[model samples]
Target: MTQLNEKLTLKQIEAIIEEMSIDGALNKLYAFKEEYGTKVDKLIVKYEKKKLQWEKEFKRFEDMRRYEKEAYSEGVKYIAGIDEAGRGPLAGPVVAAAVILPENVFINGLNDSKKLSEKQREKLFSEITEKAVAYEVGIVDEKIIDELNILNATKVAMEIAVESLKVKPDLLLIDSVKLDSLKIPQKSIIKGDSLSISIAAASIIAKVTRDRLLEEMDSIYPEYGFKKHKGYGTKEHIEAIRKFGICPIHRVSFTKNFTL
Candidate 1:
């Protein structure tokens, strides 16, 4: 054991801890408790805490996928999750996403887009797309939003997203909106983004996609700070609109109440 300790560097110890399961880590901690010094002991404590947190997070993730598991039990194959972003934004388009994730799909750190930071959402967006059986995005610009009204425009976007999916889903788990027009069976859960893995994945995809579009729009309309607020009606955004007047992307209907 002393010889083994001499050969193991701090980096090597950390690497081993990273690869070990929680049980294995605990066994190693016990076996080397007396043989290792403070540095290794600290590493073990850190890894143990991290492993416990990971276990808790994984449990929550499984719980969030209860809707999907229920659908699977009902013999529904190819479950699609649908969600929309930018519905309440004062500018930019409302974007919707439809994603069909495979059964027993596991992606760590998946949660509601609103519950995550921009970096987390961006990372999950790529991960979801890579793992999804089929995914598609539908964008309805401010012009269409003004013409159709935000509610109808969002529904249209959702319809377009579902229709564009390469794979036909047997069931749709939606975030508080039923697509009655679509032939596919759907269940809309209130705040489904927080309760359903599929809806959460769809939320992340829609949010990331809309944020990207707003960033591009920021280049064209730097005054409104689309990149910063992502078209939300924050005081800064409202101030910008008031100073610059309505830009092309501003939904006239939404901003009509605003002094601008």
Candidate 2:
């Protein structure tokens, strides 16, 4: 019988279980196989599978760290990652974030903010800010989006977010938008938000900030369900816009389906 405090390697544990009855192994593995009722031998195999899964995650984090170091060595002291949210939405503000992460900071589960669960994004958002050197956000209302068009409006939001940062960045890692007017050196990667840790951090900030704005707008327009849709051109939202004939925040250019 293994002592309660006895720690064994996975292989050693499996070999011990194989020498004992399946029932004995099952009883021994109860601590590890909490939900699954597989035989001890099967549990050992399951552990191997889980180990491989975790290894992949470890590699991903390694890659992110490598890239972070490369960005730092380029002599770009404050490299801000810029990204925006609410571009596809019909209402609400287009929000952007610029994050300057600390050189030594590393968060375990950082990824594209869109790929993360809402709870995960929220958790990382806090962790990133607490560990970041500096961060800033910018927002442009739907009125501006409609007047300037989404593409230009998004650039406007991104520029403002970058300029607003207390720590002026020497380099910008933007997600697909190039700022020709800005003096700083910039890299516009198509999916920069997914590849760059700084960009992923920025995405989380922008997403949470924009989502909260829509949630607050819900209080003003209870009938439109802004909190859930975040002002996207949903069927229900289109119906509301049609009946209400557009609110101050509604993007008139995008309301073709609702225009009466």
Candidate 3:
């Protein structure tokens, strides 16, 4: 250690500290801290803070995996988490996603879609789809939402997502909703998106897919601000409906209240 420290410049040692794990860097840097004074002391403090923060985030991630771990213990090889978005939107389709992730897969900062910003949801959507063993989304349009009603339409969307999965899941972890149409074993966890990593991944996928559709509708209709609110019954959206009346994409059932 003494020989190597003598040969290496302080700048080079700092670079090494930056690259190595906090544990290893601490071991190597502590001896140098007294000699190097403030410079090395600062690096040690920085990475000690980083180490604590990382441990906190990693604990959150592992806690989110509780459901998946239980399923794996039961010999469930593939578990798909299902969640839906846009059921409350006044326009655009209800979208649901089914995602089967590898056992104990780690996605940094994963949580319920509603908890994330648009950019964060978009980033997680891409990463979830890419890493998932099988991922698929189902969309049921405004017309279907009017016909089947939001609850039924959402169920249909979930069924479609599950059916479309390339690799059939042995079990389904749904977010506060259950589809009895499917033969797969299932559990509905209230706020599952917050509780389960798989459900959170699906929530991100479904939300992003629905948001993209609304953005496309925005280009077509331009006046409703679908892109801005994603067709939810915001004050602006309601005002637009009153100003221009409903567009073709507006859910008749949802916007009927605006007309009355």
- Name the best candidate (by TM-score): 1
Over 1-260, each residue of candidate 2 has an lDDT whose tens digit, in order, gives 34542455556657766666545565667754543334345676665565566677767866765556787887667788889988998888899999999876758788888899989989998999998889999899888888899999999998899888889888888898898878998888888887888888999999999998899999998888898888998889888887877877888788777788
lDDT of 3 at 227: 85
| Root-mean-square deviation per candidate | 1.9, 7.0, 2.5
What TM-score, to 2 decimals, does candidate 3 have?
0.91
Cα lDDT computed for each candidate against the true fold: 0.91, 0.82, 0.90
Which candidate would rank higher by TM-score, 2 or 3?
3
Name the top lDDT candidate: 1
Q: Which stretches of candidate 3 lie over 4 Å from their true place?
A: 1-35
Each candidate structure's TM-score, on Cα atoms with residue i matched to residue i, is: 0.93, 0.79, 0.91
- The Cα RMSD of model 2 versus the native structure comes to 7.0
Off by over 4 Å in 1: 2-4, 19-39
Work out candidate 1's RMSD over C-alphas: 1.9
How well is each residue in 186-227 modelled by candidate 3, as lDDT tens digits?
999999999999999999999998888888989999988988
Error of 2 at 199 (Å): 0.8
lDDT of 2: 0.82
